[model samples]
Target: MRTIRVIGIGTGDPEQLTLQAVRALSEVDAVFVLDKGSEKADLVALRREICARHAKAGLRFVVAGDPERERRPADYAGTVEAWHAARASLLEALIADELGAGEVGAFLVWGDPALYDSTLRILERITARGRLAFACEVVPGISSVQVLAARHRIPLNRIGAPVHITTGRRLAAGLDPEADSTVVMLDADPRFDHLDPELTIYWGAYLGTRDEILRSGRLGTVGPEIRRVRAEARARHGWIMDTYLLRKPGAE
Candidate 1:
């Protein structure tokens, strides 16, 4: 029997790691962290920092290189599917080498595994390989949304208002068009430019660490501001995770 622990390590701050996530880290024999090579070394380092600060037991870490994401719509889903398969195969090999028969492996996910993350799904694909029957568990961590909300002291939704969480891709396509409040993530593109500038905006970058930046104003006004800040932040950090909340008036 093989078991893999899928643990969310939160955005960047070690303080953001949940107690349960810490417990899960202590129990795993090896922690697999994705190193997107030199450009985003900070991401892998964040997991290491958390483990050093909170891991009760000494554990091993394996830094796996992440495959580049497929951006074109024509091949996006299929490309992601293929990427998962490849990642699973690579991870399975590492798991097999470490654990001959029964062993536990942990993956330190950057964000909550349940939200916009695909590690759990890829782990499932690995289990279906039948080489080793695998069971998996998740340890949730603080997400960018929580960080953004808390930083701004704003409720995601007020009373009867609805909050829709979506990707930058969908927002660029005009969002649901009917959502009162929308939270956009994974947005490399400046999607706010496409929307009606009347929408109020709250944008956050590098959301939970020392270098975190939070800015907001009317959409039209801040879009350019965020674009400028976003580029500088990304250049400084080498990587960034940002989320924004936009609402057309009458949303709440």
Candidate 2:
């Protein structure tokens, strides 16, 4: 089996795709792209653009869907494990078919594969079983955090203040060792409703795409606005990848 290079295509912009990423895209003999669901059509389009820009002659292409995600049952822990298992199974098949023919394969990872992305971990599990033999490389790109800060033009941290990266789920579960700034990602639960929001908010959705929206203000003041904007964008585009940085008063 040939090595599979997992490429982080970055947010939704062609420019955000790194040079190294382009090279990886061109070099692979085959590539497998994930189609999570219909609502994520824009994501698939972004991959199409990448392939159009860098895919070279003789490179095989494959598209795969997530096997299935089981709803968390009463024993939530068990359900979570099952979900990972299902995803693992789907990826295993893709790897075998794409790489078994002695062709190098790659998967397009949204954002950087190292940041809260599970493709690398799943590959690790598959490789451990000896069912697949492959080398992997992660090509980094601009993250939403960096893009948000740039658009807002505000330092993510105050003098000597630390920043914590968390998700809407973790924030709702209860923030940990609270820092001066907390970055919220995968914001499905509208967690800002739980925060004071007076400190600051640098929110962005569909970052780098033409339909991108960015806003910043008091969380208490901008929370509803962000929600509205997020909903309208989701409705307009069928999907969203928004993030925000929140802070406590006087921390900035």
- Top candidate when judged by TM-score against the true structure: 1
The TM-score that candidate 1 achieves is: 0.93
What TM-score, over all chains together, does every model reach? 0.93, 0.91
The TM-score of predicted model 2 comes to 0.91
Candidate 2 residue-wise lDDT, 157-246, digit = tens: 889888999877668875565588889997674755556646677899888788889998888888898888888887887767899888
Deviation in angstroms for 68 in model 1?
3.2
Query: What's model 1's overall lDDT?
Result: 0.81
**Regions of model 1 farther than 4 Å from truth:** none
Give me the displacement of residue 134 in model 2, in angstroms. Answer: 1.4
Encode model 1's per-residue lDDT on 1-252: one tens digit a residue: 777888888888887888898778777777777677787777777777877876656577777677666766587778888888888888777777765456678888877889999888887887787775767898888888888889998888877767899888777678676578899998886756668898888899887888889999888888898999999988887777899998887644
**CA lDDT scores, all candidates in order:** 0.81, 0.79
